[model samples]
Target chain A: AQSVSQHNHHVILSEAASLELGCNYSYGGTVNLFWYVQYPGQHLQLLLKYFSGDPLVKGIKGFEAEFIKSKFSFNLRKPSVQWSDTAEYFCAVNRRTGFQKLVFGTGTRLLVSP
Target chain B: GAGVSQSPRYKVAKRGQDVALRCDPISGHVSLFWYQQALGQGPEFLTYFQNEAQLDKSGLPSDRFFAERPEGSVSTLKIQRTQQEDSAVYLCASSLDGGVSQPQHFGDGTRLSIL
Candidate 1:
């Protein structure tokens, strides 16, 4: 079955720390990738998406992700994270077939301590 | 009105009772979807609708689950004889079309607890 995976289940970092959250999908076809964030008591929000072209996609609040086709990965990154950046991050993928429904990974919870 | 909205942000129901969850997609969006999120797990697709047409119900886990999008707009997901395992957050999302690249706008979701 098609599925997305996140390597980290939980992560902790101090303020201004560099961040990298890994994501990989198991599909052998063209796909669309996305990163979503959910803060405490808030709904999921789109942080960024990559459809095609430029593999390095930048999104809201200084977050970015790179789509590496060969590795079937779209890892999210941020040079520096703030305490406000603490949240649960999810990686999702839509195979280029059927109705294009998304398959999401089990999210990664990030805690940024001051 | 500006984004997807779900009704009854939280619900508590006894096992075997029927429950209906509502979803109002963004205006002009042609695609609507339903997903179930268990604790500590990703949201799993339940169903999809294009306008008033039900394009895909493959993701639905059992016959007890039903969803409809009447008038090509508002949608509802009804679960019959809810089970304890049915307790989860039900999310509704909408997009411009069922295209491969359209981004889905999600609602806050309704957290359901089946006792």
Candidate 2:
């Protein structure tokens, strides 16, 4: 079975601090990676996705993620974070050839303090 | 609709009661999905539909959970004799197709609470 692991459960950072949320998956095949963000009382929104080609992908709201194939990791990062950036982040993976059933990781809750 | 829409944003039901959750996908979307998100956890796939056909339902926890996209555009997830463990936020997502590259559009989920 495929599973995603998010190393952080909770993170606290001051405004302007850099953010890095680690995500690792246990799949050996070609996979599609995604990062989703859920704001307080809001629906989950896609932050970015990686299919093929360049390993680095930029997403909305100045967010970006690097799909390191060797490490089996797709970590999300932002140079600076604001209080508005506080939200729950989820990492999801699915095989590139199947019905695209997403397997999501336990989410990381980030609190950006002003 | 501009985006995927789910009804009864909040639902509170007593144990052993049956509850039905509705999802309306974007117009012309060929794929629809249902997911369950427990408190403080990521969403988990429950079922998938392509048009009016349910292509995959392997993620459904048990026989108590049933879903139907009779016409393909509107879907319903029915939980029979709901238990406490059934409490979670049920989310609906849709994509242009079941293709791997298509990004899914999500709706504000229906938060189900079993009392």
Whose lDDT is greatest here?
2
| Model 1 chain A lowest lDDT segment of ten | A93-102
**Model 2 CAPRI quality:** high
Assign candidate 1 its CAPRI class: high
In candidate 1, what are the lDDT values of residues A1-114, reduced to their tens digit?
A: 789999999999999999999999998778889999999988888899998899999999999999999999999999999999999999999877667688999999999999
Instruction: Put down candidate 1 lDDT per residue, B1-115, tens digits, no spaces.
Output: 4899999999999999999999999999999999999999999999999999999999899999999988999999999999999999999999998887788899999999999
Ten residues in sequence with the least summed lDDT for candidate 2 chain B? B1-10
Once model 2 is optimally superposed onto the true structure by TM-score, how far is the C-alpha of residue A29 displaced, in angstroms? 0.7
Error of 2 at B56 (Å): 0.6
Candidate 2 per-residue lDDT over residues B29-85, each given as its tens digit: 999999999998889999999999999999899999999999879999999999999
Q: After superposition, how far is residue A113 of candidate 1 from its true place, in Å?
A: 0.8
- iRMSD, per candidate, in listed order: 1.1, 0.8
